[model samples]
Each structure stands twice: as structure tokens, then as C-alpha cells.
Target: MTSVSEGRIHGGAVPLITRGPLRTTLRAGDGVRIEAVYEPCTAGAAAADGAAGAGTAIVLAHGFTGSADRPAVRRAAEVFAQRAAVVTFSFRGHGGSGGRSTVGDREVLDLAAAVAWARSLGHRRIVTAGFSMGGSVVLRHGALYTAPGVREEGGGRTEAHGEAHADAVVSVSAPARWFYRGTAPMRRLHWMVTRPTGRLVGRYGFRTRIDRRPWDPVPLSPVEAAGRIAPAPLLIVHGDRDPYFPLDHPRTLAEAAGGAAELWLEPGMGHAENAADESLLTRISDWATAR
Candidate 1:
């Protein structure tokens, strides 16, 4: 359970001034206080059960070099919160969390903490949704805990962190595999992770705390993880116009997922949650809610 005494939401909302997000630091097992916010649905939905108009809740994971406060992340949270209670958190090393990001490797612990916090708050049906790096985390985290007690390969080093019983999973603009430097954006990303100058830029400019070391064993690939999210529905959303990984990445994940996953490729989109148009977000909101 998330400890309120240890980490509490900083401020309360004034009646007419602002409906601030309910902010708290969710404590990860390794002692990282993952900065998180539980945003109830719009006022209309707030009046309904579980503040979602339904029992389902959405947990959104931001992209690489992004935190919860990023405009793109907030926009997605705002849209999704219209249909379901949205839980948005900064992965360890991003925003207010403590730790250097191992990029996609140890981030699963961050997501697991948020998911467990949502469950503790009485959200029964949880939808694990992520963008880019966070998207890959969602896929691997799902595969890690098909059963609550039996820990699997992808849950990082620790034991079964939490029961990865997401009712639905959505991956937006995620990479199928790591160390992919095929595109200009990815090449730049590699530099940011592997070089000192890039690390400095990531730390100061982007506020993304990237680790110096590479994945030793290398965590499970998104395509490999996608295959394990069976029985629990998976939605793979990618952009045909993405600069990072092309449509082939999504196709690979979709192929691994077989019939359990639905692949949607947008025509004029760029990457991650930032490029997700309102119409597409609406469809996503509907899909998560309906299922």
C-alpha cells in the first residue's frame, strides 16, 4: 500500500480557483519516491462510481526523456481522464523521482508502483497505458506477472513486484527492440545515453536522468513481451510517419501478439503522445473504456 505519512499530496484544490491534480509520491520498493498524481475524471464522471463513470482506471506512462509535467503527457492525461480516472507518474529518474534511469530496464518497478497504488485506491479495473519507453515497460511488465506470485523474466531483478493484472494494455509508438539506431532520432538518443556530453544534455536540458551503463543481460524485448500479454487485450498504436522506429516495429509486436493485439497505424502522425490527435485519443479512450 502507498504510505500517506511518508508521501502525501502536496496541496488541496480551492473551490473556484483551480482543480489541481491530487499529487503524491508513491514509494517504490527500492526506496524511490515516484512522483505521481491521481486525476479523477471530469466533474461529470467524478459524480459517478470510482470517478470514472465506470470502475476502470487508466495508468499513463510518459515517453523517453519525459516527465509527468510534459505538455504532451498532460494532454494525454487530460483526454483520458474524461473517460476514466487517470493515474500519471514520473518514472524513477524523471521529474521528482529519485534514481538514474536505466532507460527501459529498471523502469518496470516505477510502473508497478503506480499500478499497485491505483489498486490500493480501490480502482478495480486498471488499464496500463504508456508512450514510447513507457509503452515498452507496459508490455514487459504485463509479461512479468501473468500470475500474482509466480515472478517471470521481465519484472527486472526483484521478485514479482506486483500482480500485473491489467485489464487492458496500450502501447503507443514503442520500439520492438533496444539499441536500435536506424533513424536520426534514435542515433541522437544513443549518443545521449552512451556519451558524457549527451548525458549532460539529458540531465540538464531534458531533465531525464539517464544511467551510464548499458543493460548487461538486456531486458526482454517489446516484441517478446507482447507475445505474453495474451488473454489480456493489447493495443499497439504507432505512427506511419514516426521518425524513430518505423511501422515495422509495431508490425513486429503485432505479429508476436497475434490475434490478441490490435495494431493501428496513423498516417500523418509523428511520435508518442505528443502527436496523438484528439480524434485518435477519443478512439483510444473509447477502446479502453468499452473493453
Candidate 2:
């Protein structure tokens, strides 16, 4: 990390400020290289453009098989950039990043890196918004990084440092529990990550690399994680027509939060980033700003 004036830091070789967009690679706590991009808030952005928040940086987490360069992720980033600075990154084994994807297991470290990078860029307030698999990550990341006295088995985790925590979290189309195969899309997704032949399809068809190893101790579920995210505001958004996880997923998460989270069920919406439209993004931006 490169230190700059006023106590700001730059991850890898990325400078404090750049002429246009800032694109660079960040090293996670576990030494995985994550590909990330930083886009400053645009001038003269209107509320319709989702420009209600300022001086806040949103660390955008993409869903499984999604990357910073993906069309859906890029569109979301573009809309959020109008309101606040936006940081988008690819988890390990996705896009140009290093290592294999542990699904959402080790991806929390990737999000931690991005959040820390957002702080280093001088954003005092950080909001994390994720979709689908990324939504599960934001929930777990918020719980691990923000809740006081929380400790994991790994000694080198980023939670103790406090720099990776998000001031606000938005989970869109996330699941409450783990290892759920109720829906066909989820079952196919499971096969894609767990089976050798399906992993090939993930690589060639989706351009995502999957790690064959299962979770050693199985991390906290999204519902359990949601319970810990108090003080920090949480917004749970789910589509009524989501094919992956049913409405029960978001309901469980909101219930687990014990009224600390706000749940929004979008009518006719499907799943993840591809399903998140402009109006919903506008409302999300407004919510983050209010926090």
C-alpha cells in the first residue's frame, strides 16, 4: 500500500486520483489478486441518475460468474457513479483476477479488499451493494467486518483491522441459508461448481473458474450474518419472480435482522443484477444516502 498526503493510501500501483477511471489490481488479505475499477462521481448528475449520495463510495459486488467488466455489473456501476464514487471488482477466478472461486466462501476477503481500497481513496462513508451470490457476500462481509468482538478461526482475517467494514449494506436477491437446491437453476448452479464436467462448462460457458474444494468449516449463513448487522443499516431486496432462491430467502434474512433491515420485494423482477432495473437502482442509491 502506498501512503499519500492526509493519510490516504493507494492499493497496488493505483494512484490517489487519476485523469479518468482508475483501474488496478488489489491484493486481498490472503494474497489473492483482485481486479478492480474506481469511477468518480460525475458532475451535474440528477436524482433520476441516482445522484442523491455524495462523498460516499459504494463497493459493488458482482454475482457468481459475473465480473467488473460484465454488462450487468458495468451498467449498475454506471448508474451508481452518478450518485457517488463506485468501486467494482472481480472475485478470484473471475475475469482477470487470480486464484479459483471458492463460491462465496473466501470471496469475503475480496470484498474486504475492495472496501479497504474505497476507504484508502478517501471516502469516509462506504456502502456495499451486491446481487445474488454477491448479495450473500455483502451480508457476511458486513457481519464479519462491522460487528464488534466477532472473530473467525483465521487469525489473518480483515475484520480486526476495521478498515474493510461497510457503513451500509444492500443485499439483492440473496439466499438466507446455504447448500439449498430447491430450484432447478440452483441445482444446475451446484452441479456447475461441484462437478468436474460442470466446472468445464463454467469455464468455457460462463468464463468463471470454480474451486473443487468444499468449505472447511462452513461460514455463517446469510440469515445468521444478517442478525449481526445492526448499527450498520441493511436493505434486503428480492424479486418476486426470482427463480434461484424463493421469497422465503429474503424474508428469513429480514426476520433474522430483527427489524434492523428493510425488505423490498420487487414485483415481476427476476434475479440478481440483470434483473435490477434503473428505478430500483435509484431507490437503492437514495436509501444508501439516507443512511
Candidate 3:
């Protein structure tokens, strides 16, 4: 069950705002505590300004090492809030959330909790937008939650029935497959995830706690998940210059969807939330609303 509490917005990276966002602690189905924030829509096109999206809500899943309070995550929330209410949360092991990071393996439960909360708040439409590691998560979450009879790898039934299903999904700068060491950035990330000393760096330098255990049964790949998110709108956005995953990642995802998804190959954009400019964000917001 998820509980609400008044949360203050602070930290040097966060910009001063006239209104404070609603903060709460979300308990995932597995009982991990997730830190989340809800920002009301400020756009003029909506029926009521600051009415919490009126009818729509966008849930944001940040990349590895990112938190709801990060400047980049807040910036994306601010932009999306122009079109709909926004939900942003820190994955387990990041920010003030509990539990160690399972990388992308068990993070699906965190996203599910956030989406269910958004639905409970009376939003008719819920869209999920994820970046980097988060990008892969949203895809898998959409597949596991929206599709019936889809199970986890080890004969475990995914809790597919719930309000956790997203009406639409957006993935930015996510990898197609796991254990990709082709790029230098990806190699460094693997080191941070696999090595003991590297986990220390993740904890101290990045404020992210890495889980030391390996996946007992690997989860679905992003490409495979994309194929199952049909009948629901899916948007895959990737940068040509993304140092993490190349253009091929988005391409494979688009192809896997069997023409059911939209693919955008951005020019000169780097990676994740930090690289998402206002113009691009505005376009993404427009796309979500138009669907």
C-alpha cells in the first residue's frame, strides 16, 4: 500500500518554485519503499490549471542514479506538467527510497506502484515516460502489466491485472538488450554494476546503492517487451549521438513493435533527461496529448 506525506523540495540542483510538489512514500508490492512526487499541471490548455492534469497523468521513471529531486527529472516534469499532471520517483536505492538497486531487474515493481498511485488519484489517462535505464523499465512494465498471460522468466506469474497499466509509453535512450559492452559508457556502467569496488563508487560517488547479487532468472528484454505493447500507443525516442546506446537500439525496438510504435531519431541529442531540451520535451508532450 502507498501512503502520502508532506514532502519538502530542497537541494542545490532543484529550482525554487512558487508551489511545492506533493510528496509521498510508495510501498511496492514487494514492500520496498519508493520516494515519489506529484506535480500539478500548469498548462493553459488544460481545463483547470494546477488541477493535477485534470484527466491525464504522466509518470516519469528516471535513469540509473537519478532521483525525483534531480534537476533534470524536475525539468522534465515541469515540461510535461504543461500538458498533464506528472509523477516522478526515485527507484529503489536512489534518493530517499529503500532497498538496493536491482538495476532493471526488479525496478518494474517501483514503476508499477507509481502508475497505480496515479490511477487512484482519479486520472483517466496515464502515460509512462522513462529515460536511459528507466526507458527499458517502462517498456517491460507496459508489457508485463498490460498484456495478459505474460509471465516472468522463471514460471512466476507477473501480477498483470491492475491500474498499473499505462495508456501509453515513452522510452528514451534505453538499451535493446542486456550486457552490452560495445560502447565505452556502457562498459563503465557494467563495471559499476558488477565489480565490488565499482559498487562502492556507485554508493559514494553517485548516491546509488548497487545490488551485488546476479539475476537468478533474467527478465524480458526491451525489444521483446516492445512487441507486446500493441493496441496501446508506444513512442521510442533515441539520439543519434547517444553515447550509451546507438541508434540501433530504438530501431530494433520499433521493428519489434511490428509497425505499431512510432520511432523518432533525434539529431545531435546526447542522452537521457539532461540531454532532453525544452523543444523536444514540448514535442513529446504534444504527442502524448494528441494520442
Q: Each candidate's TM vs. the true structure?
A: 0.87, 0.89, 0.88
Best of the candidates, lDDT:
2
Across residues 131-222, which tens digit of lDDT does each residue of candidate 3 receive? 99999999998877763444534453334335678889999999999889999999999999999999999999999998998876778888
- Best-matching candidate per TM-score: 2
Q: What are the root-mean-square deviations of the candidates from the true structure over C-alphas?
A: 5.8, 5.5, 6.8
Q: Global lDDT of each model?
A: 0.79, 0.85, 0.83
Model 2 per-residue lDDT tens digits across residues 24-107? 888876777899999887644463255456568889999999999999999999888767789999998999999999888888
lDDT of 1 by residue, 241-267 (tens): 999999899999999998789999989
Once superposed on the true structure, which residue ranges of model 1 sit more than 4 Å away at CA?
1-20, 43-53, 147-164
- In candidate 3, clashing pairs total 0
Query: Which is better, 1 or 3, measured by lDDT?
Result: 3
